[model samples]
Target: MKVLSGIHEPTKGTITINNINYNKLDHKLAAQLGIGIIYQELSVIDELTVLENLYIGRHLTKKICGVNIIDWREMRVRAAMMLLRVGLKVDLDEKVANLSISHKQMLEIAKTLMLDAKVIIMDEPTSSLTNKEVDYLLSSISDHESVA
Candidate 1:
């Protein structure tokens, strides 16, 4: 998975996606190719709000008087939609530290979806989830597959 996601290079074989073969790939290129990964460890920032985490590095921005301003409203709307798709409903202003393990896992999934990844590789996604949460996660993934 690390090789495929471009976090590490393969020493043996080449990787082909969409009929394009890559002998060398970087993280940015992999993401541009619509590949996303969710590691077993949660990556959420405890200090950030849900909305902030969702758009951490890629915030929507608008120019005002030649100044680039973060568009909070647009980020909120898109974050809400992505969270809904992952069956996670929480206050956008809520800090991630206050969320449960399952909620944090769902937030990670939502963050991956926000990247518009066509292929998402999750590592032990259900390891921390309860039986019911696992069922719901599986169902949500199935629903997304059907839509795609």
Candidate 2:
């Protein structure tokens, strides 16, 4: 399969999300348009916890007010919900490296979910998963419409 995205300047094609053209959108706006990607091999930080991995690029701490802290409580709650939605029972605070292959993939899915992404691009999502794991992953994906 082939996928074309990003800005294609001096090119005939255009990519759009929610009616906004990629060429007209800036990097930050494009990011907010919600494009989640998951590679065959997990690209997560081994040392970070599941919750931390989910918030790797975007920090929840930045949303806090003066007296309000990162609201880790909220992040944890959302992470737990995402894990459950993805059909995994993992410790939100557990390190990514300590997880099994299936668990890691599940974590990655949950991480993407936390981003509230509208489009998800997955490459070889089932490459390293067991039969059962693949089933779960497929089922999870069927619940959403992605650009994969």
Cα deviation in Å at residue 54, candidate 2?
1.4
Candidate 2 regions exceeding 4 Å error are: 1-12, 18-20, 23-29, 61-65
For TM-score, the strongest prediction is 1
> How high is each candidate's TM-score?
0.89, 0.76
For model 2, the run of ten residues with the poorest summed lDDT? 1-10
As for candidate 2, its clashing pairs are: none
Over 1-148, each residue of candidate 2 has an lDDT whose tens digit, in order, gives 1233233332455566667655444445545777776767787788999889988766665444555457687778877878877778878889889998878877877776677778888777777678887788688777676757
Off by over 4 Å in 1: 65-67, 145-148
lDDT (0 to 1) per candidate = 0.85, 0.71
Candidate 1 lDDT over 53-75, as tens digits, reads 89889999999999999998888
